[model samples]
Target chain A: MSASGRRRSQKYHQSTPYLFIAPFFLLFIPFGAGSVLLALGMSFVDWPLGQSPELVGLDKFATVLEDPLFGRAMRNTLYMLVGFLLALLPLCLLVAVLLKQLRRRTANVVQVVIFAPITMSLIAVALVFDLLYNERVGFVNGILDMIGVGPVPFLSDSDLAPWSIIALRIWRVLGYYAIILFAGLQAIPDEFYEAAELDGAGAWQRFRHVTFPLLKPVTMFVLVASSIAAWELFAEVDVLTDGGPARSTLTAVMYIFGASFEQFDLGKGAAASVVLAFAIIVSTVVAHRLLRSDDRA
Target chain B: MPKGSFAGRMGRGTVIGLIVIVTAFPLYWLLISSLKPSTRLGEVSLIPSSVTLGNYVAAFDTQIPRWMLNTFGIALLTTLLGVVVAALAGFGFARYRFRGRSLLFGVVLASLAIPEYALVLPQFTIMRQFGLLNTWAAVILPLAANALVLFLLRQYFSQLPEELFDAARLDGSGEFRLFWTIAVPLVRPGLGAAGLLLFLNAWNAYLLPLVMLTNSEQFTMPIGLAFLHSQLNFGIVEKSPWGAITAGTVISIVPLILCLLVMQRQFIGSLTAGAVKA
Candidate 1:
């Protein structure tokens, strides 16, 4: 074909793809990217509720730095992140490994039940957990009663509120994470296991040498995703604790929310949000880089 | 390995069975609690000796039905709009080589990393500016374009053979017709997967609805449940009806459980596909 003919055909071809993609960019320009830009612009000014917006250039960031609540929220976020990593990740991995050993039919049934909670609304989970955490009539208290132990303050005490949130997070995410890990496990060719078996490797040895190494990418992905997720934990806190009993579960997202909406301190809220987003992005980037290097090695 | 010995296999089976039971206990509890009479909700019984449907009855009488309707409407809208929009965008990114494609793709991926809460305030402000607060549009409009769904669809679309598109074009069909009849059918599995996710997300969405909808009539199930909790006066003198709350909790999760059961395979496949990607 001649160059002009080829150009004409290419133009028509390219038009189709662009037309197909227009909806996403059209929506995103207004909602996603536009909102982020607005937030960034809002962060620099003293944009309080019902007040004229004033540019305060870094003052809000300075104020957020001095605010004790900001510190407390950050601390709580870290606590929850650590709790999820320490408790949830291992439990999910263990469950996935165990499920992988089961018969296919049985595992399917178990997988459905396990993944059910992930789809359940956080509000529903919170309500159910609220019942479970009820001081007098909760199922947990009922169980404690059978054991002749005093009722543990699941959502009441500030000291224990974070743990309660963590418990809920674990329950909600374990199955989904386990499914992800199991996918990673399945991707490991059966020949690898067969080869290990020929070498007289035991199950534990096979797992350690084969499964764990192969599952690293999924594990890292889960770690970063879950950490970011745990940090942004809001619905459960809002519905269950309301960051209450002394603001024990006042996550960074909650703090940003209160600052923006409740207090109408948009500048401070934007500042906090910017900081939180930066922290997540940086941590995610660092983790990815480290994992990539390990992969290379 | 001689079947790994009967004793060892038995022990492993017992452990696996125990894990499955423990894992499913909360859902089982939800079902049992839902079935119990409203009065026996907190009576510390695993099995309800006498089951009553009054709580479900009460739920219907209260705002539960309205909440369910609102949730259903919004979720369906969000899923349909989100899937259609995402599928187009995903197809674009997968098949096209255009100006700024990489940059645009990066923006979409970045949006996935940007927490929804981070955008909620600005989104709320924008919605307020447009007088959309307390409306379903406020809830559905912002969610119409989901980066995760787009990314999933893009990956799925990219797996299709180029020859299919060529074959369709040779037949002189237009782009839209080709996509509608050929591309869509080919990507139905991906659509089903993305639809399940989008539905679950919209249904379970709390923070967006909580902030967007001010009226009780507009409240979704999660917000409605929260309102119910707040309404229960558990003061020193007044006692909360734990049975009713338990019943309410059970009612809220039933639809989600049903949806999962109906689309269990696709849901599992969608989840595992992303993780297993090389």
Candidate 2:
């Protein structure tokens, strides 16, 4: 083919691909990138609803930094993240490993049952949890009564309310995360286990040496995803507690929502969002880099 | 092979059984609570001695149906728009070699890390500017460009054998037509997986709608339920209708549960596969 002919063919090829891709960029540019920049700009000013936004230049950031409630929300978010990691991650891995050992049909049935909650609206889950945690007539309190324990303030007391929210979150997410890890577990070739068996390795040894290392990528992915999810914990708070009993469960996202809608403080809300976004970005990047380093090592 | 001891099998069975019970009990409680009579709900029992359809009836008579319709419409629209948009972008990245393709693709991947909450404020402002607040369009438009869906579809499309494109070209099929007829059908499973996920996410979305839609009538299931709960004076001496709340909760889950039952395999596959790729 001559140079001009080749160039003409390449141009035709490029045009086809560009046509195929134009819709996504066209939509995303307006919604995703545009919104992000708008939010970034909105963060710098004192913008209230129905009022002209005054350019304050980092005043909102300064306020957020000084606010006790903002500090508490940050603490609550971190606590929820840690609680989920501590409780759900290991349990999910264990369940996934156990499911991998079961008969395929039984596993599938169990998986469907466990994963049922993942599809249900968070509102429904929250309502159900609210009923379950009711101080007087809740099933949880009823069970405690049977065991001679007093009615626990699941959603009433500030200290216990956040845990109640965390409990609901853990329940909803464990099965989903387990399924993810289960897939990772399945992807490990059986031959690896077989080889380990020939070496007289016990089940624990096989899991510790073979399963854990191989599942690192999936684990890291879940960790990062769940951490980010934990940061945005709002539905349960919105429905069950509404950041009640002293704003104990007021997550950063919930705080942003309340600020924007409840107080109509768009500027401060935007600033809070920017700060939250920065925290998420920095932590995720740091976590990713650490995981990559570990992988290399 | 050495046979494991009976004790070993029993122990494993007991542990698995316990885990299943713990995982399933809350959902089972919701079902039972929904069916129990409103007056007798406080009489604690694992099995309801008397069942009544009154709670469900009351729920149906209330705003449950409206909430379901709104939620379903929003979810369906988002799924359709998201899939179509993602397919185009995915096909583009998979099939075309262009300058800055890698760089653009990286931006898409980076978007996966951007928290949805971070975008809520700006999205709300944009919706307000367009006067789309309290409308379904507010819910549907912004979510149509999901980065995860785009990335998943692109990865799946790129894995197709190059010979298929050559075969289509020989048949004089244009690139767009080839993608529509050949590539799409071949990647139906991937599309199903992505579509199902997008639908589920949209259906269950609470935070975005809570922020975007202020009108009570326009609220989705999540928001509607929250409104109901907020209105319920739990602290008042008057008897709170636990039965009705449970019934409403159960009603909210029925569609999702039915969907999961019908497409359990596809749903699970999508979730697991999406996670693996991430």
Candidate 3:
């Protein structure tokens, strides 16, 4: 209770908070920051596993640019990215809107059922899709036969393979985004909708103005998050198609994995990963800016 | 929802029904195929013609049980350590206004944008240097400091009443005591939610383990099943691997489904809560 005791105690409080937070820095500095720096350093050198390192300068980046596989992988990744966003964004939002119309119990059960995929193994998902995409003796082909449509090569055809992969992703993530957006929807005060109605706003008009903007932050978060995952599209590609059917499902991360581990070309893999990192950072930053621009308007 | 319109209600029901089928059918198909006789796995019947545990028996021939143990070990360790560390820092950042607080927090938050693919190459090299390659630590350490976990915990800690802390302080309770006794118990729900999310993320982790764990003995469930699926597709073995793949897939997902069903509220809460605004 003395003044000097109080002074010492206040000093203790100031410094002990640092101790409380020390554990994060201890792990993060080495595992997070240091590794990132080392990765950037490794990108310029030819550091194959079990081989003497040699500085390669920009050659790795140039090699990535010149590689035909890289081109195909990039194209495939972009195609999936575009197709996924085109479907996922509006579809999740629409699902959220429709969810509002359901009885509470039905909606909750439906939510749990659809959200089940997020918990399932991506490999399981890949195998399941592989079964469905089988050209012969598959459920899909059987259905097509009944409908008078020829058996479609969902995974075997390059043109359809990427889209098929996209469909699987959409199916996997639709519930996740829908639930997040629905939570965001719950945050929008009913007063706003009532005010919109009083102002003669129809459902479409209210959604176009009020719902969309209020949902913007969550939407942007999902966009960047999903886009990041899309860029790192390795597991499905690895399991389902193995970047096959002429590399139609080949992805940036798959290419990186093949180069680094399979071939032991660590430098090339690091370089490609660095390039992808920059793309993710740039896109995410742009997304943040887009969110800000909304505030500005 | 068009009020009092039977057609509109039917239309919504139809659409939702279709969506449910599209999403749920894959899981259903997996379970059914996993239970079917290997000879009948190729058949188009939605339900199995003959239910058998033969596929599961075959799948056990692979290293699935061992892989599951490894994955479970990794996820459990990651959750235990990650939650404790995140909780300490979460309490620190929540209660204290120390020097460079915002700067440190912002730096941590900024690291979220660095995708795992970008970090894996360097992380692999780091693991190699530490001689952690082919070990579970390679996966656990990097994944432990999740930005969302810290963010979720910090946000939850901030919501704790300052009066509780001050009251404890007035009673001469030390900071750690207050943190352990008051802050932690209050934010237990947040911690539980964050831990479950982290465990699932770690369990479902694929790329890092695939790259680091070269030895078949050390493979996690995802990578193991992936290897199994590849073997089935390539048919390198004499017998078909479909029965095993389906069975392995089914086994791989059971834990996740159990966890999700048990912690449905927390799983949904942690994910949707954080993503809603940030």
Candidate 4:
């Protein structure tokens, strides 16, 4: 081949890959990359919508830090996060293990039933839960009435509302996470279980030694995913309680949405969201390190 | 073990059964409530004395069909645009070694950790600046560039046999032809899965649409239902919107249910496939 033709071929080869991949970067750079930087920049300026922007430096962060609602929001978020993880991890793991032991047909049916909620929109779920949590004539109160107990205000009560929201989240995600963990279980080599049986290990011991340890990666995945989701709680609270009776279910994300969109305080809202993002990052990092470091120690 | 005692098996069955019932009761209630007459309001009975289709009529009157149309358009377009772009990029990344490839791929992966809401402020601002706010483009453009789909497709495409690519190239097929013909069709499962994931994500999206679109005319199904819910006077109206809300909820979710029924295995597998592996 001529040298000019070889160089032309090289040129075609070099640019072809870029042409193929350009669409991703083209959209990503402006939207994804630019959005992050814009959010960061917006966090610094006291820029409400349709107003003169004032450079506030760390003032916006300070305002978020000092705001009592911010604290309450953070607290409520953590409350849901902790409660959700506590309910989710063990229950999902148990369900996944149970699913593993089930006959294929039964497991498929159960998996679909369990996972049905995850496919449903959260707004719808929250709306259903709202009706179910009504102080009067709610199915829940009806159940309580059947047991000769007085009507208990599920959402009206401050302490119970967050838990109720957490329950809704747990209900939505438990089966989905279980399916993920069940996939993890299926991926586990059969030899390990056989080896454990050969050692005369009981079922619990077999699960404890062979299943739990091997499922660490997936457990960690669920941990971070659910935790991030809990941190970003909005639609559920918005629909169920609207941050509720006395701001009980007012999560960080909800507060951010209300501040930015409703109140139009763009700067503070951005700062609050950045802080929430930081919290998610910190928690995910801490959780991941804890999970990884366990293998070492 | 499969050889567990009868009582133990029964106990396990009962536990799982109770859990499923509790978890699914609200949905069942929603269905039954949608079918019930307004006279049966607040009745906690599992079955209604008389089922009425009035609520569905009310629900449809509330512009739900429009909302559903909007939602379906956005989700479908997002899925199509996202899957196609991601497929091309995936194929590129998989087949050809290029300059700064790892750096670009790394950036895409890193973007995964950034939750959608975290960047809402700037994303909103960007939409405003581009005059895309309130338009479907505001939601569609940002959503179409999903890192998850890109990553999943890249991985799937890479696993395809290299020999196929070589043979295709030797047959004098150009890169674009190779990608459109050889790569995409071969990764049809991956494409379908990724498309479905994108569709579902866009369908269930709330925050973006909530912030983006101002007009009720442009509202997606979720937001429309939410508005209907909020406006519902809880059986006070001559024809209560509660039943309509329930019916709307059922209508909105029916597509998802159909999607699940149609692609149960692929849906579950594609979603969880990368969960632990990452």
Q: Which model scores highest in TM-score? A: 4
TM-score for chain B in model 1 = 0.91
Pairs in clash, predicted candidate 2? none
* lDDT measured at residue A193 in model 1 versus the true structure, 0 to 100: 91
CA lDDT, every model vs. true structure? 0.82, 0.83, 0.84, 0.85
Measured by DockQ, the strongest candidate is 3
lDDT of 4 by residue, B126-216 (tens): 8887788888888898899998888889988999897787677667778798788888888888887788789888999999999999899
Q: Which residue ranges in model 4 land beyond 4 Å of their true spot?
A: A1-12, A146-148, B233-239
- Residue A107 lDDT, candidate 2, scale 0-100: 88
lDDT of 2 by residue, A27-82 (tens): 78767877788889999999988788889999999988898999999998888788
* Global CA lDDT computed for model 1: 0.82
Query: What is the overall TM-score of model 2 with all chains considered together?
Result: 0.95
Report residue B48 deviation for candidate 3 (angstroms).
2.1
Off by over 4 Å in 3: A1-4, A8-14, A145-149, A289-297, B1-4, B236-238
How big a share of the true inter-chain contacts is recovered in candidate 3? Answer: 0.68
**Each prediction's DockQ against the real complex:** 0.60, 0.63, 0.66, 0.65
Q: What is the lDDT of residue B252 in candidate 4?
A: 87
Candidate 4 displacement at residue A254 in angstroms: 1.0
Model 1, residue B12: distance off in Å is 2.6
Candidate 2, B-chain TM: 0.94
Q: What does candidate 2's lDDT look like per residue over B168-231, in tens digits? A: 6666677888889989999998898889878988988888898888887788988888887877
**Top-down lDDT ranking:** 4, 3, 2, 1
